[model samples]
Target chain A: GDKVKQSPSALSLQEGTNSALRCNFSIAATTVQWFLQNPRGSLINLFYLVPGTKENGRLKSAFDSKESYSTLHIRDAQLEDSGTYFCAAPQGGSAKLIFGEGTKLTVSS
Target chain B: EAAVTQSPRNKVAVTGGKVTLSCNQTNNHNNMYWYRQDTGHGLRLIHYSYGAGSTEKGDIPDGYKASRPSQENFSLILELATPSQTSVYFCASGDAGGNGQLYFGEGSKLTVL
Candidate 1:
């Protein structure tokens, strides 16, 4: 079974709209991280959370270890936001990260 | 800033040939990991090391071997390459606390014909 699961495998949104991506962890994950893979294939770390929530510009993320889930919210989506978003969970006592099947986002103007 | 680098950005090998992929991290992190990303399977860990001379099997360790001869370098070896082993491989380095925040290298693209 996949320890990490991502919702909305693919999504399309009009620029200026908003969308949210979700990740569910079956393992006892202590920390979660989100990454965005751009069209050029460069991966940029978006956010790293140890439970609770954090916001940066038009992006916000929340991780609830007790509930075993995490969410990434995109507001006022821009064309530059188009990419594949991945959420990873580092299980307890393991330095290896288990990644989710990424959610591909397409923001059109 | 943390930096992780991988060598031979691209490689092509024939079946039964030996291939090696190398990774180096200047962060001096205690943990290094190797993962392969394919079309639908996402990224699957192949091997990881806790420190120098320590290599451990990951989720998909079959057909792959790893070497961690030093703290700064880790290598993935395909002793007998096959076409099915072709994929983009990424090396990442992280601290010892199991944090999900890992610094990754610009991946190495491998093709086994």
Candidate 2:
């Protein structure tokens, strides 16, 4: 059973458009972290949330523990932003994280 | 900022042979973890450690073994390698409470033939 599940398995966007990715958790997740695996296959940390919202550049993320879900919003998408996005949360009280399947995003000019 | 490095960026192993992937982190964080990345599966936890000299089994630890000799070094051992073991392995370091976002290495690609 997957503790975290991501929606829209894949996405395509035009340059300068905005898109949002979502993750639903089946477990009691206290915290959430978002990561982006770029075209080069490097997973870069995006945002770490605890029931609130955080914005960085063109990216914004929010987590709601009570709702058991999280969202990563990408604004003004660029070609370089094309990649897979993953949202992760810990299972119960452990330090180990359970990850979602990931959303493959492609932004074309 | 945390620094996590992985050795042998790429490796190839013959079936039934032994393979060891090494990782070192200089963040001084007490929590470290190893995960594997596959096409459909985002990332699966293989092993983790709270501190030096301690290794804990993760969700998928049956075919893999882990060793944490010190705070800076952690190794994942694949004894009797199999083709199914081929994947990209990642090493990460984070705070003990696990609230901090994990700092990751570039990743190590291992191919088992």
Candidate 3:
């Protein structure tokens, strides 16, 4: 059983459209973080949440510790948004962060 | 911004050969981790360390070994590289405690023939 699971393993969207990605946790996660891995394989941190929601520009994320789930929403998606998205959850009592398999997004004009 | 760098961005090794990947962090974080990414498995933890001279086994530690000789450096070694070990390896550093976020390097791509 995976501690963290991501839905819609892969997604495709037309530019300017909106989309959402989800992550479900089997473990008791205390904190969650989202990252976007560019084609070059460079991972850029998107959001870090304890609980509740946070928004930055066209991206927004929410984490519900009680439900053990997290969501990342992209608004007015652009071609540059094409890349792999990952969500990581920190173990309840450890400093380690468990990562989801990742969701690959391909946005085209 | 926290900086984490990995050396030998790409590597090629023959079966039964030795392979080592290195990671360094300028953030001076206390926790470091190693993970391998495969097609369907995602990112699987291989090893981690809390500080210099400390190494802990992660979810998938077999066939691999790790060394944390200093606070700024961590290395992953494969005594006998196999094709199965061929994948993209990632090194990350994080601050202490569960609330802190982890910062990652670009990654090292290894190919075993």
Candidate 4:
């Protein structure tokens, strides 16, 4: 079984539209992080959450440890956002991290 | 600015050959990690380190080994590369407190033939 599961394995949204990505954790995760893997294969850290919500520009992320899930919301999508979005959480009692399969987001013009 | 760099952005190896992937971090973070990404799968942790002179095995450490010689350097070793080992390897560094924020490198693509 997967320690973390991401919803909507693939997504396509139009420009200026809003969309949300999600991750559900089966383990007792204390922290959750969101990353954006660009077309060039570089991972850009978007948010690191303990249990609350965070917002950066048009991107907002929320992590609910009690519910064992996290959500990433993107507003006004752009072509530059066309890539893969991943959510990760650390293993219980260890520094090791577990990641979701990732949601491939493609924003069309 | 925090930065993590990976060497030999791309590599090709023969079956049963030796392969070494290196990572360097300028963030001065105490924790560093190695992960592999393959199509259809999430990023799988291969190995990690707490700090200098410390290394720990991640979930998938069966065919791989790791070393952290210094605070700024970490390396992943593949003693006997196989075709199944082909994947993109990423190196990341961050604080040891489980802050959830990890600085990642550009990733190294390895092909085993």
Candidate 5:
């Protein structure tokens, strides 16, 4: 069984629409981080949260340690936002992070 | 800018051959990690290091070995490459605490035949 699981393996959205991605953690996650892999296969860090919510431009992320889950919300999506999104959490008492399968997002104009 | 650089952006290897992926970080982070990404598996940690001379096994370290010789360099070695090892490898560096933000490299694409 996967320690970290992501929902909606794939998603499609219009250029100006909004969408949210979710991740469920079976491990005791104290903190969570979100990353976006662009078309060039480069991974970019989006947000790093500790059981709280953070907003950066059009992207907002929330992590709930008590519920063992996290959410990433994208507002007013753009073509540049079309990429694979991944959520990861640090392993208990270690620097290692376990990742979810990722959500492939496509923002079409 | 803080960066993590990986060599040989792409490589193709034969079975029973040796493959090495190297990572260098300019972030001065103490924690470094190597992870592999597959179609259904987003990213699984293969190995990690706390510092220059410390290496630790992650969730999936069976077919790979890792070395951290200095604060800025870490390497992943595959003694006997197999078809199952074909995937994109990523190296990341982070602060000492587990809750710090991580910086990842561009990734290395490896194909095994």
Candidate 6:
């Protein structure tokens, strides 16, 4: 079984639309981190959460440890956002993070 | 910003040959990790290190060996490469207490024939 599972394995959205990606954790994850892999193949750290919500420019993320899930919301999507979104959680008492399969998102113009 | 850099951005190796991927972090983080990403699967951890002189096997460590000669340097060694081992390898560094907050490198693409 997968320790971390993400919903909507693939998604397509139009520019200026809003969308959300979710990750459900089967492990007792205390924290969550979100990453964006761009078309150039660079993994960019978007958010790191600890059982709470965080909002960045055009992006917001929430992590619920008790519920064992995390969500990332993107507002006014852009073509540059086309790539993949991944959420990861650390193994209990270890630095090794288990990652989700990733949500492949494509934002069209 | 945390900077994690990987060497040999792209490489092609033969089967049964040796391959080494290097990672360096300038953030002075105590923890470093190596993971490989395949087409349909998520990035899987192959090995991790805690500070200098310590390396631990991760979930998939069978064909991979890791070394942490210094706090800023970590390397992943493949004794005998195989086509199944061809994937994009990423190196990350994070603070000891940062939980899972990791900064990743650009990733090294390895192709084994």
True contacts kept of each: 0.70, 0.66, 0.74, 0.70, 0.89, 0.74
Q: At residue A104, what lDDT does model 1 achieve? A: 97
TM-score of each: 0.97, 0.98, 0.97, 0.97, 0.97, 0.98
Query: For model 2, what is the alpha-carbon lDDT of residue A105?
Result: 98
Q: Give each prediction's DockQ, rounded to 2 decimals.
A: 0.79, 0.78, 0.77, 0.76, 0.87, 0.77
Per-residue lDDT tens digits of candidate 4, residues A24-53?
999999889999999988899899898999
Which tens-of-lDDT digit does each residue in A1-109 have in candidate 5?
A: 8899998899999999998999999999999999999999999999989988999999999999999999999999999999999999988858988889999999999
DockQ of 5: 0.87
lDDT by residue for model 3 (A1-77), tens: 88899998999999999999999999998889999989988889999998999999999999998998999999999
Q: Cα lDDT of model 1 overall?
A: 0.93
Between 2 and 5, whose lDDT is larger?
5
Q: Which tens-of-lDDT digit does each residue in B1-113 have in candidate 4?
A: 57999988999999999999999999789999999999987799999999999999888998999999999999999999999999999999988876547889999999999
TM-score of chain A of each: 0.98, 0.97, 0.98, 0.98, 0.98, 0.98
lDDT score at residue B7, model 3, on the 0-100 scale: 88
> What digit string (tens of lDDT, one per residue) describes model 6 on residues A1-109?
9999999999999999999999999999999999999989999999999999999999999999999999999999999989999999988868889999999999998
Candidate 3, clashing residue pairs? none
* lDDT against the true structure, each candidate: 0.93, 0.92, 0.93, 0.93, 0.94, 0.94
Question: How much is B94 displaced in model 5, in angstroms?
Answer: 0.6
lDDT of 2 by residue, B3-110 (tens): 999988999999999999999999898989999998888899999998899899999998999999999999999988999999999999888976667889999999
Clashing pairs in 6: none
**Pick by lDDT: 5 or 6, better one:** 6
lDDT score of residue B49 within candidate 4: 95
Candidate 3, overall lDDT?
0.93
Off by over 4 Å in 4: none
Q: Give per-candidate clash totals.
A: 0, 0, 0, 0, 0, 0
TM-score of 4: 0.97
Best by DockQ: 5
Q: Can you write out model 1's per-residue Cα lDDT over B10-95, one digit (the tens) per residue? A: 99999999999999999889999999999999889999999999999999999999999999999999999999999999999988
Q: For model 1 chain A, where is the 10-residue window of minimal lDDT?
A: A89-98
